[model samples]
Target: MLKGLARIWFCWSFPTMLKGLARIWFSRLTPNSIDTFKELSAQFASYFIRGYKYKKSTTCLISIKQWEDEVLRSYIAHFNKEALLIDEADNKILVAAFTNGLWKDKFLFSLYKNDPKTMADVLYRATKYMNADDALLAHEEKPKKRER
Candidate 1:
């Protein structure tokens, strides 16, 4: 009975851990197709293992541009997501790719004026900008006082 309950717990929690395309793929599987945790693991591994073998190159980061009118926080979030998938990504290369993808904005100017040598430096600077952006957004979102 404990083993059954454990299986039920794992089956319930497993899908919640998936993200993006993997989540979608898991959701679309036919009902009863995965009766056991082993079956589910095998199916998931077989489907995704092929893609795992081909890790995305750093060059992919070069293509992730900040869209027009997109907020700094959004762009940074998107960039970091892709950056995480890369294996042994070079700091210099990541810094260059991140800089190249920026739209003409305050952050771009900042990057140009004080170039970051490493990905850590870039992320640190971006964190400050992201905070500033969030603060500005919060300020804008506050209800203004009504004129008497």
Candidate 2:
């Protein structure tokens, strides 16, 4: 998957995933910059969803495919699962560990109950734009009841 991620870098003409990661890095800033953060979220949404389904698509899937061709397919013939976790104090720090792999370990976790830890689910819930965790970490906030 690292290779897939790498290809996205090239496809998007970015040397690195800095733009996407920046949302996590410099989230503390003036309100003017929040719009930029939303753009970043839209930019990377493809990477998580159907990036390869349409033409153009910011070429995110191209990056993923490129990585699949060069590294992932060769390194990990089998697509495995992995776990991801976030630091309690700082939810931005993502922690990943290996659980399984194919010929070689491509992913860090296996697909099972004891699979590697995951933070994507939780992260999605917490973030408002790309890295908005302020509301998420607020446990004291009351939830609105759904209409019956």
Candidate 3:
């Protein structure tokens, strides 16, 4: 997606490609903590590509409480924005790695060619993780049994 944007960089005429990338990557979130973390990972990578277009975002990264809010869900549904929005407060932050769309290979390859180090930086950030003391979580969330 960003590859598409980069291809059009010379023409300077396609904010839509950027929007497409944002929506594709942003909507993959599930309104859960881990998903939010993953979104952060993706967005950080996109910071280079998206640049100042998202200037009104109050925070560089979103906090967890913002993910749990219902108003955010409603806005995404309303706009038919392929990306998820947490609310009118601008709580959600979408990142490129978290975005699901495929980049046109030529553009991405050109990106790699122009700046190998930048691509490396993006990859390293996406793959890094915090070693917090939080318990290892199970893959499934089971429903609690009803008490008699």
Strongest candidate by lDDT: 1
lDDT of 3 by residue, 81-134 (tens): 332332333212233322212233432344345442332353343233111111
Residue by residue across 8-92, what tens digits does model 1's lDDT show? Answer: 8877888899988688778889988767667877988898987753358988998999999887778889999998888899999
Residue-level lDDT for 46 in candidate 3: 67
Better of 1 and 2 by lDDT: 1
Which should have the higher TM-score, number 1 or number 3? Answer: 1
Candidate 2 local lDDT, 1-148, one digit each (tens)? 2367776565456324455334444343344453443575675574446533212222221122223244433322221111111113222222121111222322322223334245454333323222333445575588789999
lDDT of each: 0.85, 0.34, 0.37
After TM-score superposition, the amount by which residue 28's alpha carbon in candidate 1 deviates from its true location, in angstroms, is: 13
Clashes of 1: 0
True-vs-predicted CA distance for residue 83, candidate 2, Å: 9.7
Q: List the candidates ranked by lDDT, beginning with the highest.
A: 1, 3, 2
Instruction: Give residue 53's lDDT in candidate 1 (0 to 100).
Output: 35
Comparing 2 and 3 by lDDT, which wins?
Answer: 3
The local lDDT score (0 to 100) that residue 23 gets in candidate 3 is: 51
